[model samples]
Target: MLTLSIFAVLLLMLLIDIPIAVAIGLTAVVFFVAQGQSSFLAMLPQRMYSGTTGFTLLAIPFFILAGNLMNCGGTTQRLFRFARALVGHVPGGVGQVSVVSSMIFSGMSGSAVADAAGLGQIQHRAMVDAGYKPTISAAIVAGASTIGPVIPPSIPFVLYGAITSVSVSRLFLAGAIPGAVMGLAMMLAIWLMAKPRNLPKDPRANLHEIWDSFTAAFLPLMAPVIIIGGITTGFFTPTEASVIASLYALALGFLYRDLTWKEIPAILFTSLKQTCGLMFIIATANFFGWFTIFERIPDALITQLAAFGTTATGFIWIVIAIVLVLGCFIDGNAIFLITLPIFMKLCPLYGVDMVNFGVVMTLLIMIGNLTPPVGMCLFAVESFAKVGIWSLAYECFPYLIAILAVTILCAFVPEIALWLPNYVMGAAG
Candidate 1:
C-alpha cells in the first residue's frame, strides 16, 4: 500500500505539471513521510550526492558543452548545406534534408534536445521557408531528432553504463547499426510521402558545390569520427572522449572565427546551467532509487510478474509498453534512472542480453522525446515553429511509428543490437 501510494503521488504530480526533479524528489519525500519516519528522510542527501559524484557522470556536461559550442560556432549551417547537397533532390526535399541533417548532427551531439533545439531551429525554419506546413516541418524534425540518443556517443548510454556497469564502448558500437537503420528508415518514409506532394527540392548541387560544402563542413564532421575512433581504438575512454570533443569544438569555434573570447563565459555559464539541472535530476532520482531498493520494489515486481506466468519475451514486451506509455508523460533519462535498477535486476532471470537490452532500452525510451503532452523534443520544436503540440504530434506520428517499429524489431532480433558490438569488441556478452 505504501509503495503504491508513493507511485500514485509521483504520477499525480507528473500529470499536474510539477517539474520532473521536483516530482521525483517529492515522491521520495512522500515515501519517507508515509514510512512513519523522519529517519528515512536523512538518507536522501547522501544518496543524491553519491549519485552525481561518479567520474563517469562527468561526461554529461562536457558533451553538452561541446554540442552547444559547435551549434553556436555555425556547425549547423555547414551541416545543412551538406545535407541539402546530398538529399535536396529527393522527394520532400526539405523534409528529407531535416532527416539527413539530424542523422549527421547526432554523430556530433548525442543529445535529442540539443539536436532539436540547435539544429532543429535551422532545419524547421528552412522547411517552413520551403513551403512546408509549420506543424509538419516541426514534426519532421522532432521525429528525426530521436536519433540523437540512438546514435553513438550518447549521453543516455553513458548514464546507463555508469549506473549498470555495462561497457560504454560496447553500448556505442551496439547503437551504430540501429541508429543507421532509423536514419535510413526516416528518409525512405519521407520519399514515399514526399513524391506525392511534389515537395520542393533544391536544384541538384553540382559536384563543385558538393565539394565546397563538404570541405567547409570537414572539421565539424570529424567531431564524431574523433570521439568514436578514439574510443573504439582504445585510445581513450568515453570521459576522455568527451573532454576531447569539448576541446575540439573549442578549436573549431576559434578556427571558424564564429565564437569569440567574449562569448566563452556565456557558453560556459549556459553549459553549467544545463548540467546542474541534469545533475539535480540524477541526484534526486537516486534518492528515489535508494528508497525503491530499500523496499525491495524490484523483487515485488518480479514476483508479481511470475505469478502471472510472464515469460521472458512477455516481460520484455510488457516493459517496452510500460516505458512507452510513461514516456508520454515524463522525461527519458528520468525514466531510465528510476526504472533501470528494477529492470537490470530482472534481466538475469529473463535471459535478457544486457548489451542488447541496454541498446534497445535507450532507443525505446528515446521515442518518448518525440511523443505528445510532454515530449521534450516535441515541445522544443513546437516553440520555434509556433505550432501546436497536437498538430506536431499528429504530423510526427508516422515517423514515430517507423522508429518504434525498428525498435521492436531490435528487441526481437538481438543480433541487430549485438552483432556489431560483438564483432567489434570480440564477443560482447
Candidate 2:
C-alpha cells in the first residue's frame, strides 16, 4: 500500500507537469512526512551531495563542454560534408547523410538534443532545400539524433555507470558495435523508403571531392578516436578523456578560426547551465533512489517477479518495455535514475551481465528520446520544422522501427554489445 501510494503520487506529479527534479524530491519528502519519518529529512542534503560526488560523473561537464566547443568550432558542418561526400549519392541521399553524420557527431557530443539542435539544423535545411517534405526532414533529423546517445562517450552511459558502479570504459566499448548497427539499420530503412518517398539523391562526389571533405573534417573526426583510444590503452580514464576531448575541440576551434575568444564565455556558460540541470536531477534522483531502497521496493519487486519465475531474457524484455512506455511520458534520465536501483538488484538474481544490460538500457533510453509527448529530439527538430509533434512522430516511424529492431536484436544477443568491450577490455571482472 505504501509503495503504491508513493508511485501514485509521483505519477500524479509528473502528469500535472511539475519539474522532474522537484517532483521527485517533493515526492520523497511528502512520503517521509506521511510516514512520520520526517527526522530522516535532515539527511537529504548529504544524500544529494553523495550522488553528485562520483568521480565517473566528473566526465559530464567536460563532455558537455567538448560538445559545446565542437558545435561552436564548426565541427558539425565538416562532419556533415564528409558524410555527404561519402554517401550522398545513395538512394536516400541526404537522408543517408543525416544518419552517417549523426553517428560520427554522436561520438563527439554524447547527447541527442545537441545532435538534433546543432547538426540537425544543417541536415534539416539541406534536406528541405533538396526537396524533402518538412515533416520527413524533421523526422529524419530527430531519428538520427537518437544515435548520438548510443555511440561512445554517451552522457547517459556515464550516469548509468556512475550510479550502478559499472565500468565507463567498458560501457563505451559495448556501445560501438550496437551504435554502428543502429546507423546501418537506419540507413537501410531509408534506402527501402527512398523510391516510394522519391527521396532526392545528391550527385555522387568524385574521389577528389571526397578527399577534400575528409581532409577538411580530419581533426574533428579524431575527437572520438582520441577519447576511446586513450581509455582503452589506459593512458586516461573516461574523466580525463573528457578533458582531453574539450582541449582538443578548443584547439581545433582556434586552428580553424571558426570559434573566437569572444564566444568562449557563452559556450562555457551554456555548458555550465546544462551541467547544473543534469546534476540537480542526479541529486534528486539519488534521494528518490534511496527512498525506494528504504521502502524495500526492490525487494518487493523481486518477490513479485520471482513469483512469475522470470528468466534473465524475460527480465530484459520487461525492462525494455518499461523504458519504452515510460520514455513516452518522462525524460530519459529521470526514468533511468528512478528504475535503475531496482533493476540492478534483478540483474544479479537473474544472472544478467551488467555490461550487456547497461548497453541495452542505454539503447532503450535512446529510443525513448525519440518518442512522443516529451521526446527531447522531437522538440529540438520541431523548433525549426514547425511540423506538429505527432506528425513528426508518425514520419519517424520507419526509423524508429529500424532502431527498435536493433534494440530487440541486442536484447536477444548479449554478445552483440558484449563482444567489442570484452575484446578490447579483456572482459569485465
Candidate 3:
C-alpha cells in the first residue's frame, strides 16, 4: 500500500503547509525510497527533465509572459470602460460591469485571482460605494472571477493539453460557447439578486460613448484575435502565438505609453517568478503522474470503477461530484494535475469524448474556485474586500448553483463544449 501511504504523506504535508510542488515531488520520492528501489533514484533527474521538456510546454512561459505584459499595458481601464458601456445599465449596473469586465479580461489574464484582485477590487469598491452590501459585492466579484479560466487562452487548458497531448487550439475553441453561457448565467443571477435589493443602475451608454470606449480598447482587444486567429489559421503554432502575443502586448505598452522601457526589467522578473513556480508544479506533478502509473493506479481505479455498473453519462456525473468535493479542499490546478491522469484514462472505456471531457473538466474545476472553505477565488476576494469568507460564500451560493447548472448542461450536451471546436477544427478523435 505504498501508493496509499505516499498519498497520505502528501496530504499531511499540505495540511502542514508544505508547498504543492515540493509535496508532490517529495511524495514520489517517498514511494521510491520506501520500496527500496534505489536504482530508480538515478533516473529521477531524467524523468523530471523529460516531463518538463515537451515542446508543447514551451507555450506556458510565453503565455504567462504575454498575460503579464497585457496586464502591465494599461488594458484594464479601457476594457472596464468598454464593459461599462455595454452593461452598466443592467439591473445591477455596477455588479454587471464586474461580470462583463471579467468576461473581457478573462480573454487576456486567464487567471481568476488576477482578475479578482485587479478588476474585482475595482468592481467591489464601486458596488460598495453605490450602497450595496459588502457581502453581496464580495460575492459578485468572486462569482464572476470564475469565468477567468474558461475563456480563450486559459492557462489550465494549456496545462491539460501539455499533459494529455490534446490540441491546445481545439481546447480554446471548445471553451467559447460554454464560457459565454456562464457569463450570461452569472449576469442573470446578478440581475435577480440585485432586483430585490434595489441596487443602483448607471445610465445606458449612448452610441458615441460606446464607440469611443471600443476604439480605446481596440489594441488591447486584438490580443485574443492575434493569438487565437493566428493559431487557428495555421500561421503559427500555439508556442509561436504566445511569443507573438507577448511582442504585441509589449508594442501596445509602447503605444499606450503606460508601460515604460525603464519598467520592463521588473515586469519580466515578476513574470519569470510566476512562470517558474508553475513550471515547478508542472514538473513535480509530472513526476507524481509517472509514479502513479508505475504503481498502476489507473488500472486499479478502472477495475474498481468497472464493477459499479458505470456508463458514460453516469460516470461523468460521478466524476463531477468527486471533483467538486475534492475542489473544496485543494487548489484547482493541483486537483487537475492529480486527477486528470486517472480520469482521462477512463475516457475510452466509458465511451467519453476526450475533447468534451477536457472542456467539462476545466469548467467544473473552475466552479470549485468559488466553492467554500478553500475556494481560491473566494479567499482572494474575501481578503481584499474584507468580507467574512463564510458570509461571502453564503451570498455566492445562488451563483454557484447557476454555475453548477451550466456545468451539468455542458456535461450532458457535449455539443455545448464541442460545437465550436468541431465546426472550426474538424471532428476530434
Once model 1 is optimally superposed onto the true structure by TM-score, how far is the C-alpha of residue 62 displaced, in angstroms? 0.4
Instruction: Compose the digit string of candidate 1's lDDT tens values, residues 1-429.
Output: 655777778889999999999899888887677678668898888999999999888889999998899888888889998999998987889898998888888887789998998999999889889988777788888988899988888999999998888998999889999999998888888888886766677778899999999999998888899999999899999999999989998999899899999999999999999999999999999998888888889998888889999998899898899889889888999988888888998999899988889887888877888887879998888878888888888888888888888989899999998898888778934
Query: What TM-score would every model get versus the actual structure?
Result: 0.97, 0.98, 0.94
lDDT (tens digit, per residue) of candidate 3 on 150-269: 888787888889888889889888887898999999999888877788888889999999999999999888888877898788898877877887788789889989799988998899
List RMSD in Å for every model shown. 1.3, 1.1, 1.9
User: Highest TM-score: which candidate?
Assistant: 2
Off by over 4 Å in 3: 1-6
Worst 10 residues of 2 by lDDT: 420-429
Per-residue accuracy of model 2 over 1-429 as CA lDDT, tens digit each: 676788789878988999989999999999999889999999899999999999999999999998889888789899999999999999999999999999999988899888898889999999999999999999999999999888998998999999899999999999999999999999999999999999999998999999999999998998899899999999999999989989998999999899999999999999999999999999999999999999899999899889999888888889988889888877888988899988999899988888888888888877777788888899989998899999999998998888889988988898999999888778743
- Candidate 3 residue 338 Cα shift, in angstroms, is 1.2
Counted clashes in each candidate structure: 0, 0, 0
Cα deviation of 209, candidate 3, in Å: 1.3
Error of 1 at 394 (Å): 1.1
What TM-score would candidate 3 get against the native? 0.94
Cα displacement (Å) at residue 413, model 1: 0.6
| Best-performing candidate as measured by lDDT | 2
